[model samples]
Target: MKYIKIRIPKATVYFTPVEIEKLLNKNIEITNKLLTQQTEIFKEGLKRGKCFIRSSKQKIREERKI
Candidate 1:
């Protein structure tokens, strides 16, 4: 199979291409763990950035209203 699907927490839809699997000797566990960790970090950073932007915009709108 060129691609393999893994079922992991917040990583159920992850697909590893054969090239990477071969590089890791067909060990998908490490790949999934690394991917999930990276995904979590990215999501957290995005959430924090978006929340800050939204709050700033809301403050601007409120200032205009008053």
Candidate 2:
């Protein structure tokens, strides 16, 4: 048997290449869409006062919960 490994911020998981490719493609598609409409997205978020950040402690807590 063969394996593929993915290292996320707080966790690692193994997947088959096909699964990884699918995930990668999906993420790329979503990212591209977001970029195309980034201004509108930002405007909407600003209107709602919503935002996100990369938080290590939050990642650690989520990983521990998982």
For all predicted structures, in order, the TM-scores are 0.51, 0.47
- lDDT (Cα, tens digit) per residue for candidate 1, span 16-49: 6856557676467778889999999999999999
Candidate 1 Cα misplacement greater than 4 A, ranges: 1-28
Clash count, one per candidate:
0, 0
Global lDDT scores for all candidate models: 0.82, 0.82
Model 1 has how many clashing residue pairs? 0
Clashing pairs in 1: none
